[model samples]
Target chain A: MSELLKIENLHVSVGDKELLHGINLTVEKGKVHVIMGVNGAGKSTLMHAIMGNPAYKITKGRILFEGQDITELSVDKRAKLGIFLSFQSPVAVAGITMENFIRTTKTTVSGQQQKVFAFKKLLKERMNNLSMDASYAERYLNDGFSGGERKKSEILQLRLLEPKLALLDETDSGLDVDAVRIVSKNISEYHNENNSILLITHLNQILQLIKPDVVHILIDGQIVREGGAELADEVEQNGFDAYRLAVKGDGNDEA
Target chain B: MKEIAINRLPVLTYRYLKTNDTKILFSAPQVSAAADFSDKTYVTVGAEFPENFEGASSETLAAALAGEKYTITIPSGMQAKLTIEIKLENQHADYAGAYHFLLQKGAKLELVWKLSGTEAAQGSYLASYYELEDAAELKISKLQADLAEATLYDQRFFKLGKAAKADVASAELGGKQVIVHSRGALNGDEAALTERTVYTGTGKQHLDLFYHIDHWGKKTVSLIDGKGALAGEAKKIFRSTLDFHRGCAGSEGEEGDYAIQLSPKAKNISLPLLLCTEDNVAGNHASSAGQVSEEDVYYLMSRGFSWEEARRIIVESLMRPIVDSLETSLQEETLEEIRRKLDAKGE
Candidate 1:
C-alpha cells in the first residue's frame, strides 16, 4: 500500500512546554489506524497538529500529505486539500445554521458554491441515516446539541465531506451504548477504498465495529507498540497496564 | 427655534453636535399620507396627534419647524399591518414628522418602520404615539441604518388598555448621532409589554437610548431587553426604567442590558433602574459589557471563515434576538446591513 500521510519526528508545543516529543507515524491508503491512549497521552495534540490548529505549535519535523509537504499550510488550505479533523468539542456558531455551515464549508473545499436545493437533499438523506431530526438542519451549529447529538453532528460532517484523510479525534469518546453504535456505524461508513482514516479513541466499542487495519498504543507522545487489528482486541480485554508501567520509567512529557 | 427644552436628560444630550436652524419640510413624500389601508387598514399617517406629550424640545421643535403630522384609527375587531419605509430623500435636507394610531377593542396592528439616511448630511426628528383599546394587540418593528454624517431623534409613546398586549422592537445599524426615547403606560389590568432593541456604534458616533415603562394597572408585565456593540471611539449610553405603581400588585418587570465592547477606547454606560411602589411584585435588572472572544474567532477560522466573517457571526448572534422580531420580509435586509457594518472592521 502507498503512504497517504507521513509524519517525521513531529514535535508540537502549546506555550513554554512541549507536548509531543519526537513523534513519528504514518497512515496508508484505505487503512484505519487507531491510536489507543490514556488521558494526557498527546493523542489530541497529534490530531490537532495535523489539522493545523493554530493553538498547537509545530516546532520541528515535516508532515507530507499525498506526497506533498503541508507542514506550513493554513487550516483552510489543509481542509481544501481534503484533510478534515473532527474536533472533540465542536464550537457552537450562533445564527449560522448547521446546514449553512456544512454547505458553505463544502463549497469552500470544493471551490464551488453548492446549490441550496441539492445540498438540502443530500443533508436530509445524511440526517435520516443518522436518525437526526430534520429540524436540526435549521438550528444553530451545535449551539445546544446534546452530547450524543454533537457526536452525531461530527459523523454527519465526516459522511458528507468524505475527505481524503480524516482525523477522528475521539468522535466516539462521549457516547452511550446506542450513541456509540450509531457513531461507529457512521465512522465505518466514512471509510472507503480511496481514502484513509486516523481514529483516536480509548473506547473499544468503536474498534469492535471498524475492525482497524492497524493499531498503535500512543504513550506520552510516542508510539509504544504497533500491531494488526488483534492489538485492539488485546488492549480491550486487558487495559494498557503493561505499557502504563513501562512508560512510567520512560519519563515522557505529561500531556 | 423657540426653545429645545423637553427630553433634556443630561447624559443623553449631545450639546456639542448642534442641529440646523430647525427648518420644517413644507411637504414630504405624500405617499405616506395616502397608504391603502383596506387590507392592513394599510396603516399609515392619517391626522390624529396631540399637540404634546409635555412636548420635548425635539417634539416642539419639529412641530414648529418641519412639521408633518398624521393620525389613523382602526375600528373594533379590525386587523392592520402598517409597513412604512421612511427614506430621507433630501440628502442634505432636514426632516421632522409625527404620527398617531388608535386601535379599538380587540383590534390588532403590526407596524414595520424602515428609516434610512442618504449620502448627504441630514437630520431628522419623528414622534409616534399609539393607543390600544381593551384586548387590543400592537407590534412595532423599526430598522434604522446608513445614518453616517446624520442625526436622528426618534420618540415613541404608547398607552395600553385592559389586557392589551404590545411588542415593540428596533434595530439601529449605522448613524453618526442617534437619540431614541420611548415611554409607554399600561393603564389596564393584565396589560403586557415587551421591548427588544439592538444598536451598533462605530467611528466617532454617539448613540443614546432612553426608555420608561410604567405599570398603572394591576398584574401588568413589562420587559426591556437592550443589546448593543461599540467599536472605534464610539460611545453608547442606555437608560431604562421600569416603574410599578402602588396599585399594580402581582406585577413583574425585568430589564437587561448586554453590550459587546470591541475597542478599549469605546465607552459603554448602562443605567437600568426599577421603581416599585408595590411589595408583591417581582423585579430584576442586569447589565454587562464584555470583549469579543478571540477563541470564537479561532474556531470559526478553523471552519474556513475569515476574521471579519467570524466577528460578524458573533455580533449577529448578539442581535439575533431582536432581529428575529422584525417582519419576515425585513429580517434578511436588516441582517445584511448588520453584516456590512461589522465587515467595515468594527469589532
Candidate 2:
C-alpha cells in the first residue's frame, strides 16, 4: 500500500519543556495504526504537533503528507488539505448551533454552497444513525453535552468530514461500554479503502472492535516497538512496565 | 477624558459636555386626546407635564426651546405600545425633543422608538421623563441606525412608585458620535428598574453611555446590563452607577458590561460604580473586553472555516440574543439587517 503520513525525527516542546524527542513514524494509506502508551507519553502532544496546534512547537523534523512537505501550513490550511484531528476534550463554544457550524464547515471544505434544507436532511439522517437526539442540531455545539454525547459528536464529525487521514486523540476516553461500541462502529465505518487513521488510545475495548493493522508501543516520546496487532494484546496482558524499563535501556527493542 | 477606559484606551477626542441645543416643545397636542401614536408620517402627541415641572434644568431648557413635543398616557389598569419615528432635516444644528409619559396604577406600556431621517453631520438630542404609578410596568425598546454622519445625545429620567418596574432596552448601531445619559430614582417601597443596551459600530464611530439608579425605598432593586461590539476604528464607553440610600436597606443592584473589540484599532471602556450608605445591601460590577482567541479560531478552522469566517461566527454570536428579542415582523427585518452587517465585516 502507498504511504499516507510520515513523520521524520519529530521533536516538539510545550512551553519551555520538551515533550516529544526525535520521534518518527509512518502510516500506510487505508490502514489503521494504533499507538499505546502510558500517561505523559506525549501521544496527545504528537497528535497536536502533527495537526499544527500552536501550543505545541515543533523544534525539529518535518511532516510529509502524501509525499509532500506540510510543516509550515497553518491549522486551517492543513484541515483544508484533509488532515483532521479529533480533540480529546473538545471545547464547548457557546451560542454556535451544531447545524450552523457543521454546515459552514462542509461548505468550506467542499467548496460548494450548501442548501440548508438538503443539509438538514443529511444531518438528521446521520444523527439518527448515531442514535443522537434530533434536538442536538439546534443546540449549541458541545455546550452542556455529556461526556458520551461529546464523544458521539466527535465521531459524527469524523463520519461527515471524510478526511484522507484522521488523528483521533482518546476517542474512546470517558465512554461506557455501550458508548465505546457505538463510537468504534462509527470509526470503523469512517476508515475505508481510501483513508487512514492514527488512533491514540490506551483501552483495549475499542481495539477489539476496530482491529489495527499495526500497533506501536510509544514510550517516552519514541516508538520503542513496532509490530503486528498482537503487540497490543501483549501490552494489555503484560502492561507497559517492560516498555518503561526498555526506554531506560534495560529491555530489548522489538522492531 | 472618558468616564471610563478599558484596556488602556487613549483619551477621547470629544469632550463630555453637560449641555446640548435640542429644544423640546411644551405645548399640548392640538389633536384630540385618546388618539393612538401609531402611524409613521403623523405625530400628534405632546408634552403632558406641567409648565413648571421642577426637575432637571437641562430638561426644562430643552423643553422651553423645543418646537414640537409628544405625550401619551396609559390610564389605570391599561396598556399601550407607542412607536415614534424621528426625522431630522437640520444642518449642523442640535435636534432635541421631550417625550412625556405617565402610567397610572397597575398600567403597563412598551414604547418602541425608531430614529431615522437625515444622516447629516449634526447633533441630535432626546430627553424623556417617565412617571410610573403603583405596580405599573414600562418597557422601552429603542432602535437607531443609518446616521453615521451625525452625533447623538439622549437623556432620560424615571421616577418609580411603590412596586413599579421599568425595563429600558436600546440598540444603538449608528452615528459617528453618540452619547446617552439616563438617571432614575425609586421613591416608593420595593420599586425596581432594569436598563439594558446593545451597541454595534464600525468605521470611526464613537458611542458614550451613562446610567445611574438611586434607591430611596426599602428592598428596592436595580440592574444595568451593557453589550457592545466594535470593528474598524470605532470606540465605545459605558458608565453606570448604583447608589443606595440609608433608608434603602435590603436593596440589591448589579451592573455588567461585555464588549467585543474585533480589531486592534477598536476601543471599549466600561466603568461601573456602586455606592452604599445602607448596611444591608448587595451590589457588584463586572466588565470585560477582548478579541476572539486563536484557540477558538483554530477550533472553527479545524472544521474548514478561514480565520476571517471564524471571527465572524464569534462576532455574530454576540448579536444573536439581541435579534431574538424583537417582535416577529421586526425580528425578520432585523435579522436581514444583521446578516448584511455581518457580511460587511471590518477589523
Candidate 3:
C-alpha cells in the first residue's frame, strides 16, 4: 500500500486561540482510519484543517497529499484535487435544487458537462439506493430536511463525488440505528482499493458495520495511541477517561 | 426638457436622503405611436381614456406625459388573454403610453406586456390601470428588457371590487435607470391583491421601486413581495407600504423586500412600512439588504465551485423563483438578460 495522505506536526488555530496542537498522521490508499476522542479533543479542527477550511488556520507543519504540499490551497482548489469533507452540520441553501447542485458540482470536478436526462437517471438511481424520496431531487438543497435526511444527503454526496480522501466529521452523530446502518453501508461501498477514509466518531454503532484498518485514540489534539481495529472496541469499553487522566498527569508533571 | 418629481413616497422622510421622491428629466417624444398587438373584438386600439382613470403616478408629472392609450374590456362571465408588445426605435428618443383594462363581474383575464427597445439611449414612460368589478379575476405579467443606455418609467394602478382578486408579477431586467411605481386599492369585501416584483441590476444601473397597497374593505388581504440582486456598482432603493383603513376590520396585510448585493461597491436600501387605523386589522412588514452569506459561499466552494462560480449560482438561485414564474418565452428572455448582466454563460 502507498501513502495517500500525510500530516506532519500540524498546528491549527482559530482566531487568537490555538485549537490543534502539533499533530502527525498518515493514511495509506485503500485503508480506513478511525479517530476516537472526547468532546473538544480537536477532532473536528483536524478534519477542517485537512480540508482547508479558512476558519482553521495552519500555523505550523505541512499537509502532503500523495507527497505534494497542499498546506496553502484554498478549499475549492483542494476539493478539485480530490479532498472531500462530510460536514457534521451541512448548511441549508434555498433556491437551488438538489439535482442541479449535484450536477453542477459534478461538472466542475469532472470538467465535463452532464447530459440532463442521463444525469437525472443517475441521480434517481443513486437516490433510490439511499432510500431517499424521489421528490427530494426537486427540493431545495438541504432546506427543510430532517436530521436523518441531512445525514443521508451528505452520504449521497460522498458516493457521488468519489474523492480520493474523504474526511468525515462525525457523520454518524445525529443518525438513528437504521440510518447509521444505511450510511455505513454507503460509506463501505464508496471505499475501494484506490480511495481512503479518515472518519471521526464517538459511537461504536458505525464502527461495528465498517471495520477500520487503524484506530487512533486522540487526546488533547495528539494521537496518544494507535493500534488495530480492537483499539476502537477498547476505547468504546473503557471510554476516554483513562487517556484524559494520563494527559492530566503528564501536564501536572510539566507544571 | 424639464424636470419633474415622480414616484413620491406617501409619507415624508429626511430631505437629504432623497428617498422621499425621485426627479427625472422629461420631454414628450415626437414619435408617438400605438403598440403592436393582435387586435381582438374586446380590445380597442386607440380608445379614449376613461374619465375616472387614475394611475399610480397620477399625482406626479407622469400623468401629464401619458400618450397613445389602449383599452381592453372583458365581458361578464368571460375569459380572455392578451399580449401587447411595445418597441422603441431611435437613439435619444422618448415614448409614452397608457393601457386601460376593465374586467366585468365574474370575468377573468390574463395579460402580458413586453417592452423592448432598438436604440441604446432612449426614454419610455408607461402607465397601466386595472379595474375589476365584483368577483372578477386578473393576472398581469410584465417583462421589461430595454437597452442598457435607456431609461424606463413604469407605473401601475389597481382598483378591485367586492370578492375580486388580482395577482401581478413583474420582471425588470434591463435599462440603465428604471423607476417603478405601483398602487392598489381593495375597496370591496373579501378582495385580495398580491404583487411580486423581481429585478437584477448590473454595471452602473439604478433602480427605484415603490409599491403601496390600501385595504379599505372588510376582510381584505394584500401582499407585496419584492426580491432582487445587485451587482457591479448598481444601486437600488425599494419602498413598500401597506395601509389598513379604519373601516377595514378583519383585514390583513404583509409587505417585505429582500435584496442580495453581489459587489463590494453595490448599494441596497429597503424601507417597508405598515400603517393600520383599525384595531382589528393585522399588518406586518419586513426588509432585508445584505451581501450573500459567507458560509453559503464557502459551502458551495467546498463542492468544487470557484468563488465566482459559487457567487453566480447563489445569485441565480435567489432570483430563480420569480424568473420561473414567468411564461416560457419570457422566462428564457429574462434569464438571458440576467446572464448577460452577470457576464455568465448559459448553463
Per DockQ, the best of the predicted structures is: 3
Candidate 1 pairs with clashing backbones: B6-B56, B6-B57, B24-B65, B24-B66, B25-B66, B37-B41, B37-B42, B46-B71, B47-B71, B48-B71
Total backbone collisions, model 3 = 0
Per-residue lDDT for A96-184 in model 2, tens only?
78888788787788788899999899889888878899999999888899987887887888777789999999999999898898889
List model 3 lDDT by residue over B1-347, tens digit each: 67877667788889998888777665555545347775576877655555554443453324423466777899999998888877776643556777778899999998888888765547677777888999999987889875667778787778999999998888988888888888899999999999888888888888989899999999999999888888888888888999998899999988998888878888888889888888999888998878888777777888898888788777777777777777666887887777677774321
- Model 1, B209-279: lDDT tens digits are 77788989999999999987888898877778889889999889999999988889899888787887789
Task: Point out where model 1 deviates above 4 Å.
Answer: A250-255, B1-66, B216-219, B244-254, B273-284, B345-347
**In order, how many clashes per candidate?**
10, 6, 0
lDDT of 3 by residue, A1-255 (tens): 999999999999999888887889999999999999999999989988998888899999999999989999988988888988898889877778998889888888777898999989888988888889999999999989998888889888888888999999899998988889989999999999999999999999999988899998888887777888988988878787778777777433211
Give me candidate 3's TM-score against the actual structure. Answer: 0.92
TM-scores for candidates 1 onward, in order: 0.86, 0.81, 0.92
Select the stronger candidate by DockQ from 1 and 2.
2
TM-score: the better of candidates 1 and 2: 1
Candidate 3 reaches a DockQ of 0.68
Candidate 3 off by > 4 Å: A248-255, B14-17, B31-34, B46-65, B247-250, B344-347
The lDDT of model 1 is: 0.79
